[model samples]
Target: MDLEATKNLSASHTIGNYILKSKLGESSFSTVWKAENKITGGEVAAKQVYLSKLNKNLRNCLDCELNFLSSVNHPNIIRLLDVFEINLGMMFTEALLLDMVLRKSIWSSSASIMLEILKQTVIYMLSVSIIFHFCKSEYLQSQDECCVFLVLEFCSGGNLASYLQQHGRVQEKIAKRFTQQMGDGLKILQSHHIIHRDLKPENILLSGKESDVVLKIADFGLSRVLPDNHVETVCGSPFYMAPEVLQFQRYDCKVDMWSVGVILFELLNGYPPFRGRTNFQNIKSSSCLPFSQHILPGLHPDCVDICSRLLSANPVQRLSFDEFYHHKFLRIKGVGKYHGQ
Candidate 1:
C-alpha cells in the first residue's frame, strides 16, 4: 500500500542482470520500476507481475498483451526486450529501456511546452505496426498469479489527465491541433484492425511540449482483434463507452469511433457528454444526450454534424473510419487539406 512497504517486499528481487532500483508504478497484479542493469549499465523499465493473481481467462488476456508487444513493430507501442522467471509464482519483464515521462513533466515550465510533446507522440504512432504477442512463461509458473508487463516509450510529457488539469480546458485552436493528430492516429489503428476500446483523455498520453504534443492511444486491455465476422464484448468506461456497448448489443470497431466522438465533444464542450450522480446510473443512460443542443453555438455546423454521426447509437449509421477522415470536422480542423479538397 505504501512505497516503503513495496521496496521491502521487492528489494531483494533480481531479474537476470538488472537490479531493481525503485518501484515506479503498481497495480492490483503487477509492479513497474526504474532499474539499472549491471550487465549493460543502461536503465530499463522493469515490470514485475505475479501470474497467480490473475484468473484463467485474464491470464490468457495477459498473454495477448505480451504477444502483441513482442511481435508488433510500432514506434508508438511499447517494446518487450526480455523476460525473466522468478521462482514459481512470479515473473519479471524487462522492457526496452524507457523513462517515466509522467514524472518528467514535473520539470516542464509551461502548458505550451507540454502540448508540443503530445504532438510528437501522435506522429510516432503513425509509423509503426500494431502487433500482438503472448507470454506463457508466467502462466506456466502459477496460473493464479500470472500477469503481463508493458514497457512503453518514454514520453517526456505526462498523461492527458494531468495535462488537462495543469492547463485546464484547451483553446479552440489548441483542441483542433489535438483532434487532427488524434484523428490521424486513429486512422492508423483502424488500418491495422485494432480497436482501442478505451479512448479517453486519460489514455491519450502527452509527450511534454505545447507545440510538440504527440498523442498515443495507450491501454488496450479492453481492445480486441476483430474476427472475420464480428466480436462482442460489454466493457469500457461508462463516460466514453458507446451506446451500443451500454445496451449490450453486438458491435464492431464503431465503439471506438463513439469514444473519439465523446472526446472531441469534450474538447469543445469542456466536459464529457455523460456525467451522472453515480457511475452505475451513468452507464445506463449516458449516451442518450443530444450533442447539437448542448454544444456551444459558435461550433461550426459541420463539426457538430460529424460528431453527431459518430455518436449515433446505430453502429451501421455511425461514421466509418474512412468517412471520419473526410468529415467536415476534420476538414475544418486542417487534417486532410494538404493533398486536395
Candidate 2:
C-alpha cells in the first residue's frame, strides 16, 4: 500500500516515527493527541488538523500559529519542536526529521506554581539571549482526508479551568499568586506585540512534577500579533471580555488584562464578577456593575486595586502592562492573609 493509503488504513494510526496514543483535546479545526516518539520513549502532543475542515479563517489562524511558534522563543510559550507533512490518503510518503520536544506541562493554578512562574520569568529577563537560538518547526501534509500534525510540548498538570472546577476556587493569597504569574507571562507576550484575544483560565496550562507545577500559556488559535491599527474584532468569551470588545470598539492588549481581572475575581470570589441571565445582559453588566466598590470588601487592598484597575470600564483607564510588572500586590513576600478580610 502507498504511505497515504497505509495511513488511511486506520483511524488509530502512526505518522512518521510518532505513534498516536490517545486524544488530548479537539476544537473546531484541530484535535490534539498524546503521542509517543518510537525511538526516544518521550511523550509529545500532536495537534492534528485536517486540511478539509479548515476554512480560510482557520487556515489563516493555523498559519499565524505556525509563524509565531517558529519565530519566537520563550520558556513560557510551547516550543515547536518539529513540523513535517505526510500523505494520509495519497500513495507516496516521506519520513520525519528533527528531535527534542519540551517536556513539562503547565503548573496548577496555585501558589507554588505561580511563584515558580515569576521566578523563571525574572531569571529569563536577567539573562540575555545574545545569539539566535534555533528551534525546528515541522509540518505534516495529509489529503481531503489529509491532516497537518503540529507536534507540541506536553503539559501534564492540565489546564486551570479544570483545576478550579475540580478543586473549587482558591483563597485570596493563592489566587493572587497565580494571577501574578499570569501577569508576568502576559507582559512578556505583550512586549513581543502578541495579543491573546482569548485569555481564559482554560488556555493556561500547568506542567511539572508532583512536587512543583509551572504554568504556561497554550492554544494560540485566537492569538495574533499586534496590527498597525486598532483591533476591532468583537471576539473573546462574554463573561471575561472587556466592555470595549463587546462594543466592537478599537482595542489593544488591554483586553487580555481585562480577562485577567475577571479570572482573578473568579478565583478570589468563587464566581465571575459579571452575572446575567442572558449574554447581552452579561455584556451590559461589564459597564453597569460597580466592580470597584463591590469587590473591595474582602480582598487585600492591593488586590482590589489591581483588579479594579484591570476591570476598568474605560480601556484607556485600565491598568497598563508596566503596572503589573511592578505591582505591590505581587511583591508582597510570603502567603500573607487577606488583610481586607
> All candidates: CA RMSD in angstroms?
15.5, 16.2
| TM-score against native, each model | 0.70, 0.76
Best by lDDT: 2
Off by over 4 Å in 2: 1-12, 91-143, 209-211, 275-277, 292-297, 334-336, 339-341
lDDT of 1: 0.63
Cα lDDT tens digits, model 2, 1-341, are 33333333333467777888887778666678888888897988887776656666667667777888887676567777777754354312212100111111142556676566556644543342211122212222322255678888888888888878876767676776678778777766777788888888888887876345566777887777788888887767788888888877899888888888888888877678887777678777888778764664556778888888889989888987788657788887754466423
lDDT of 2: 0.71
Q: Write the per-residue lDDT of candidate 1 for residues 40-140, one digit (tens) a residue.
A: 76766677666566666456556655655566655444446676544322221111111323444568888887677656554543332121113344434
Residue 213 lDDT in model 2? 54
Candidate 1, position 15, lDDT: 57
Q: Name the best candidate (by TM-score).
A: 2
